[model samples]
Target: MDTPLISASALLGASPAPLLLDCSFDLADAAAGEQAYVLGHLPGALYVHLDRDLSGAKTGMNGRHPLRTRDEYAAWMASVGIGPDREVVVYDRQAGMFAVRAWWVLRWMGHTRVALLDGGVDAWVRAGGSLATDVPVPKPVAITPAPAPAMPTLDAAAVLARLPGLRLLDARAPERYRGDVEPIDRVAGHIPGARNRFFKDNLQADGTFKPAAQLRAEYAPLVDGAAKGSVVVSCGSGVTACHDVLAMEVAGLGTATLYPGSWSEWSADPERPVEKSPAA
Candidate 1:
């Protein structure tokens, strides 16, 4: 069986057809991603905004991009022409960062036919796949959404509960993890015991993810002897963390619980311990 990645060439010839979603987004510029999508995308790709569609309505300390309710997410999926058990191929700007959010959401909702466009839109264009400026019109679908709240998640308290036994992976840049630079979050540094593994490290020089064996090796140290539920994945606002989850799943490590609030919510509280210097 192939990995959860669908390459540009494979996408070009996908049988039974695959629903392509453009999940391009600039965290710095909220509107830029949508603007890029409106300019041009795959022939039949639909845009999935990180803020508007993929995430929930932010009320307070719930983090920047919280997961939406099952009903809301399913409705959005339907509007994008997603049917139950349909094949989906999500893409972003040549990197799997943002697109995997859609992939993770689908899997959380019990849709197993979801995959990502390896190397993303740039890979498609580079591979001679045509782009379309015209937006696609997909017929709205009506399907009962499957809710799996048990989809391996860690709440702010859950993280604290398992603090001693947990192996938390922080998917932020090294600088952010070291407290050398704080880009988007309120505070610098990371959860006291969490290890740093930049999500981009999962990709090759060409931006496609590393092969399964390599990824398995990369994760083996952290996952050894750990109960699957004890591994928590997190990042700034819980976005890029999915990239690591996707990579791990590709690596056959199975799925880890997502700390959706992540550092964003964790840091907001003064009680949680924050560590600045890197581990010895």
Candidate 2:
């Protein structure tokens, strides 16, 4: 896969500069996240709210952070000056977690030109890029997002039907995956047939992603004999799971379908089986 990662240095002084987005958010304190962005962010960067700009109204089984309608998202993009030809670069302070959400969301809306700022906003500062408290205003540009009945998504029933070969990967922490401690969702365990692969494993110690080859090697065994499209990526509320999907794309493993109705939705259904492991 062609890399969708942009290096901080490469982005510096880029001609026809990309649309910079700050996507940092605290799951617990939504207001604080936006405040953090207002305090200091990349010059000319616009702030994207995780709960507002990136998500849609939640219907009964739509899961938390359900994706907004394609048309609605397109309008939002236009209002923010995003168009098909724009080079959009999204970043966050939290090791690409929230940023990748933006990346996946854009792709889901049929814009493949969006890229993630490698290692996120922190990397920018480390590369000597300065933060600006001022936000830039740009003229709105209209775009027509391609039509799709829905994003490539897997429901809980579909996941259960996939059975033993499905390769359902859970992006939660080991403790949460093993049912030791679930900080967010109501349930402490994971989907019955899911395997634990913390989203952070895709990155290096410096908060940057591991090289493509390394990522490929890391994921090969876990996905052994499974069709690339057969693998389903998921997490508590379908957020960090995008991180795994992004890593797979970077590794050239091909795209994995997302289970937007992740553990949060899965656990809500009493009929769905939950699994806990002594070893996560």
Candidate 3:
């Protein structure tokens, strides 16, 4: 199935083939998921929280948020009644922050038939779509865990070994990238040989993604003359980095692999070098 933004009207009626997911989450507020869902959500949408559903136990020194295992994610999907053939549509409160993470996870697990809701729930409401306060409890569907693809990922050793060939794309704000300000992690700065590309840059003023042609033009110079697959994306803790990956996909560029550890893991080890300037 081709990736296309689905409308709230299309999802209101019975859509057995389509799975509508409301991936609304706020990192600061843990109760944001149910609060947002309770206020009013797209009709017949299932809620998926980033911290509760998408992540696993935070083992110290590993990362701030580690991804759940494949089996875990598959079980959660099955419990939420997502089947392999279902055309999934994910949306979040803001543009596509949390929704894009779900999109990337599906892609990593080898599911290609998924799309983000353009402009998200706000757009749906503006388009005269219906909303419901009550959450729908769906019957569990059996799902087989698909094998995750062995895309190019890098550890500190691998990054050090191929520093020249691999272009690390840091999907953090310019301030955080430059060690000017860090509100989350303990240490500031970025991985060595990494370039900053704030994830928000991929979106328009209205929170929707820019056109494919515009996105292509913006990213072409960055990956120009590089090998078929040379870009690796990382963020504070691997969540927002998927935004960059999705943008690259929309731009018609080859899929960029994610560094799930990101800065959270990279900074844990003082032995690994961190750079404050672009030259670093």
Expressed as tens digits, the lDDT of each residue in 10-125 for candidate 2 is: 88868888898899998998887789999999999999999999988986566778877788888888988888788899999998889888888888887778889998878899
Local accuracy of candidate 3 as per-residue lDDT tens digits, 23-90: 88887887886688888988778888888887788876667767778888888878887777777888
Prediction RMSDs, each to the true structure: 1.7, 1.7, 2.4
Segments in model 3 whose C-alpha atoms lie over 4 Å from true places: 4-17, 150-152, 278-280
Candidate 3, residue 118: how far the Cα is off, in Å: 1.5
Clashing pairs in model 3, backbone N/Cα/C closer than 3 A: none
For model 1, the superposed segments whose C-alpha errors exceed 4 Å read: none
Compared with the true structure, what per-residue lDDT tens digits does model 1 show for residues 1-280? 1467888999998887788899999888889888999898998888888999999988678888888888888888888888886789999994988998898888888777889999998889889998889997877889656666635787898888877657889999989998998988889999878888889999999998899999999988878887655578999989899998888888888788899999898988889889897544
Q: Residue 95 lDDT in model 2?
A: 87
Output the worst ten-in-a-row residue range by lDDT, candidate 2: 142-151
* C-alpha lDDT values of all predictions: 0.86, 0.86, 0.79
> Residue 264's C-alpha lDDT in candidate 1?
90
